[model samples]
Target: KIQRQMGSSYHPEVTMKIQVPFEEFTLQIEGRADGVMETDEGTVIDEIKGVFKNLDAMKEPVQVHLAQAKCYAFIYGE
Candidate 1:
């Protein structure tokens, strides 16, 4: 709904497979991002998270969320 106001464009439920070398084994990191947007600011990743509790109970997003967002950013080569 909110996306209509934003000039950004996105690909929803997008996934990418990347290989990382861990010692002698190749590690694969694969998952889907909520959405990836192309905006004037730059390529942005939209990671939608919902909290069940009251807004006050929520703190900042956890490290994992930030990391995941960045991983998606890397996948897009932005």
Candidate 2:
């Protein structure tokens, strides 16, 4: 619903894969971002996570989930 309002700037279910250089090898990271948006400011990566508990009880995003979002952003930037 909200995606439709954003028009062409919003891309839903975007899959991204990227490789990063490590100490002596390369690391590959791949995942799907719920939505990616392009705006005057910059690119936005949206990651959706299902909650089984009260949302209010969560003070911060899960570390793994946050890492995935960061990976998506890095892939897009690359």
- Each model's C-alpha lDDT? 0.76, 0.87
Candidate 2 per-residue lDDT, tens place, 1-78, comes to 777887789999898998889999999878788899999999988898898989999999899998888888878888
Q: Please identify model 2 stretches exceeding 4 Å from their true place.
A: 1-3
- Scored against the true structure, residue 20 in model 2 reaches a CA lDDT of 83
| Each prediction's TM-score versus the true structure | 0.73, 0.81
Could you say which candidate leads in lDDT?
Answer: 2
Residue pair clashes in candidate 2: none
Candidate 2, TM-score vs. the true structure? 0.81
Candidate 1 — worst ten consecutive residues by lDDT sum? 1-10
- CA deviation > 4 Å runs, candidate 1: 1-8, 56-59
Q: How far is 20's C-alpha from truth in model 1 (Å)? A: 1.1
CA error at residue 3 for candidate 1, angstroms: 7.7
Please give me the total number of clashing residue pairs in predicted model 2: 0
Q: How big is the positional error of residue 52 in model 2, measured in Å on the Cα after superposition?
A: 0.8
Q: Report the lDDT of model 1 for residue 59.
A: 78
